[model samples]
Target: MFTRKLGKTKIEVSEIGFGAWAIGGDAWGPVDDGQSLRAMEAAVELGVNFIDTADVYGDGRSEQLVAKLIEGRRNELVVSTKGGLMGHHRDPNGEPVYGRPAKVIEAFENSLKRLGTDYIDVYFCHLWWDKQEETEAFIEAFKQLKRDGKVRAVGVSTENFDYIKHFNREGGLDAVQLDYSVLNRSVESEVLPYLEQHGIGAVVRGPLRMGILTGKFHEGTTFGEGDIRRNWPKETWFADSLAKVETLKGLVNEERTLSQAALRFVLNHPAISVAIPGAKTAEQAAQNVSASARPLLSDEDLSIIARVK
Candidate 1:
């Protein structure tokens, strides 16, 4: 419900954005297009102006769905999408490929067509390239898009905080999306501080830790066959995450649900511009936006959550 400025781009976005990965119906599991559309519409109705999707998500299916939902109200929304990761219609598990200048141009064109938009508010390099040279080339290409009015801002999504620090130092990006949650505080050490100092907006993904922070599962919970969680390392990673979630239950009470507290925890940070949590149904969308209305976590609440694992 609250809005924040996205770096120096002059674009204002909702604090709780719609994460469109699950709506794409690829890595997460099977998805219903009807349900996804309703979820997106519900988000818009609830005042969500930001939507983040990737070109690789369901091979552009997510962008198409977002396009369908925001058909007549393009100017009212700040739609951000990523490119550079390549996937084919036949091969769903293909590896990501770094976008050279030519690839970057082609990817932007494809995403524009899929999203049915003349310009993207923010276009991120889906993942960091192995070489700085490659990343520079992509940023140059993104600048070209900006010059042509095809893209308004450029960003990068990555876990490597060092790359982010360098990019910020060089003034190469307008925003940075990274995985950050109560369970994942690695970004607090350096990445967050640097972004805040440089006036670079930070879009936090996995604010709910892929649903673990929602308190929806227990130790023995089983994921569906096609679910991406099935491939997660259950012996240590999954079990440990579930254990952390149990510890987080104390933060949830009559005031809010575990999911709501989890979202607010990420939003409490001064450096964070928005948190994108994925939803597949209208009820889920409503539940997520409700968190934006709640007060942020207190110092004691943050202390308690920080003690987990």
Candidate 2:
């Protein structure tokens, strides 16, 4: 797999990393534990060193599964996990719970226990906070975690660049995880450029737009009951995304699947550090890693993509 520096942390990570959300199960329909392990092992064998997960993912099932993946290979992998939405401890109103430093530390400790690790490679706040003061408080809490040798890097997983500004107010932020795909270019206007300017790494999630860009879904596609995308509006957002995916398929050819082509399109930008596409099985994981070996998207292909929206 191709490698890239995770911006300010200077940590080398596979350009195509594994996103562990789906493997956590429940949220993405039924998932086989054996398949999940094989998927992780397959990706690791292919040199996938970066994996992103969240504590809220299956209520810690994801991190526990990842703990298995890194058991004997901790030094070889870069793991990024998130917290802040677990609600283990909350205010009476349950508002701004993570704004409290103690709660932040509590969430971190729980994540560490679940991951079976003494220190996390990258830890991100899993939700956004509109309140600037609360956001700054969370940043300070993360900075304290770094100071305590509990996490190597600190960031927030959010699409709000304004929230990101607060996270990086003191210039201690190391990275940010956000959704960016051929179908979701909203980050290009602000989030990507800010991360590039401020030297914060960008870990892109949803690079496949929840499997739409894989050309596996169509207007007739319907998500399973437990899958998160099951509730997406079919006639509106869903139809529009599939329509755009059809346009994106023009870049696909004999050399790569549409999934690989979509991944390659995301990696085409210099601003992006890594793309974490979710995989539920070994075949999917191998397919994601294969994108790193495919040729880069050409200027002509990009020109065609520009008109997709």
Candidate 3:
């Protein structure tokens, strides 16, 4: 496995990180503690040094399990979890009330207590507050946490192009977890180049495009209600994302899966610091980590990748 620096910070992570949202086991679907621990163990054994989690995920279940999973192995991983997105209190309309700083800090502290660790390796603003003052407050709160040794450094996770650059200039985040993939090239237009210029690491979240890139889902494939796949509407580019899968199918030999190809595509770019695709089982974790050492596609294959739907 290959490791790289996370932005200009001293933190170094495996190119493939363990994305722990699923370990929280709610929006993605129902998962038991036993299965969750196995998934975490697989990632660590395979040299995946970065783990991404959030406070609002399952309202602290994910963080606590992560704590137990990493209890003695803390020195080997770059554990990054986020705050913001108030937990379990949806409005009457069933929308999350995000960006309550005082409450958000309370959430962070709760995560710390649950993880049973004194400090988190990486903490991020889960999302922007949509107001300058609020965004400023988010950054300020994270910065204070860093000073108090509650977090190593802070970053932002979002897909908003305009907001990423604006926040970079104004809020001064150490990193930003932006969405990017061969299918999602919009970031290359400006956001990625911006991160490179500013020395802000970009931790890509959906390199697999919700497993659609695995080229295994057929037209009739359907996820159950509790599955995260159900959370994404059919109208989403990813839900009905078979177009890119078919395109990628044309690029690789039949034996190579879309999962490997998609990951390789993201790592092909030097600007991409790490790709944190989620894993629900040990097999999935092994499949993802293998991409780091795999041969990159030929230029011709890459040209085909660029042409993917």
Candidate 4:
């Protein structure tokens, strides 16, 4: 796995990080703890040093599992977890609660206990509450976390690119995590350029479009109970995405799988520091890490994937 510096921080993370969302066993459907551990172990064995999770994911289950895997080997990995969002375990979505220093500290403390670590590599804001004053207060609290040695660096995972641009202007964040992939190129128009210019590391989530780009789902495919994909906007969106995936399959052959091609397409962008694709099993973890071995997509390949409507 290739490594890159995480913005201005001294930490260097693997280009292919392990995303622990699925292991939480909440919105992604049923999962085995043993399998989750094995998958994390497989990722580590394959040189994956970065793992991203959140306090709200499975209501701390994900963080606990990640802590179990990296317990004694903390120095070997860089763990990035988020806070500031809280809610019931049964609900996949969490309520945004930021600004209050006490609440922020409490959330960080809880995450620390679950992660079994004294300091987090990168503690993200999780989501912006859309209130400028509250957001500023949240950033202040994050700085305090760094000053207290509870966090090494601070980041924000938000869809509000304009807010991110303003945050960057104020020198508030070291990294930004956003949804970006072959099927989702909305960020390319502005967000990518802004992050690149400001020197903030960008972590690409949903790089496979929640498995739609993996070619594992087709029309009429069904997800098990509790799978979040089942709640997606509309049926037409899925059908349209599947059609685009078909066009993308022509770009894949014997040497590469659709998932690998999809991941590589995201990494091909210079602004992306790493791409986090969730893996539920050991085999999936190994496959995700191996995607970094393939050469970057050519200009023509990128054009083909981008032009697909």
The C-alpha TM-scores of every prediction are 0.93, 0.95, 0.90, 0.93
Q: Which candidate is the best by TM-score?
A: 2
lDDT of each: 0.85, 0.87, 0.78, 0.84
Runs off by more than 4 Å, candidate 2: 86-96
lDDT of 1 by residue, 240-300 (tens): 8887887888898787899999999899889989999999999999989999998778887
User: Which ranges of candidate 4 are over 4 A from the true structure?
Assistant: 87-97, 232-234
Per-prediction CA RMSD (Å): 3.1, 1.8, 3.2, 3.2
Q: Over the stretch 1-309, how does candidate 2's per-residue lDDT look in tens digits?
A: 889999977689999999999998969899988899999999999989998999888889999999999998788899899887643455788666676777788888988888888889999887754655456567778878988988889888889878888778779889989989888899898888889998899999999988888898866667889888887755587888877877888888899999998899889888889999999999999999999999988887888789885
Better of 1 and 4 by lDDT: 1
lDDT of 3: 0.78
lDDT of 3 by residue, 1-309 (tens): 899888888888899998888878787878888887888788789889899988877888889889988898787778889876543345467644433456456767878898888788888877644555456667667767877887877888886876776666664677889778877888887778878887888899989876778877776677787786764446566544676677678756654666887898888777788999988888888888988877788888787876763
| Residue 194 CA displacement from its true place in model 2, Å | 1.5
Off by over 4 Å in 1: 87-99
Residue-wise C-alpha lDDT for candidate 4, range 68-168, written one tens digit per residue: 99899998899999886541121233433554666677888899999999989988887644666456756788889989988888888876887787666
Q: How close is candidate 2 to the true structure, as a TM-score?
A: 0.95
Name the candidate, 2 or 4, with the larger TM-score value. 2
Estimate the overall C-alpha local distance difference test score of candidate 2. 0.87
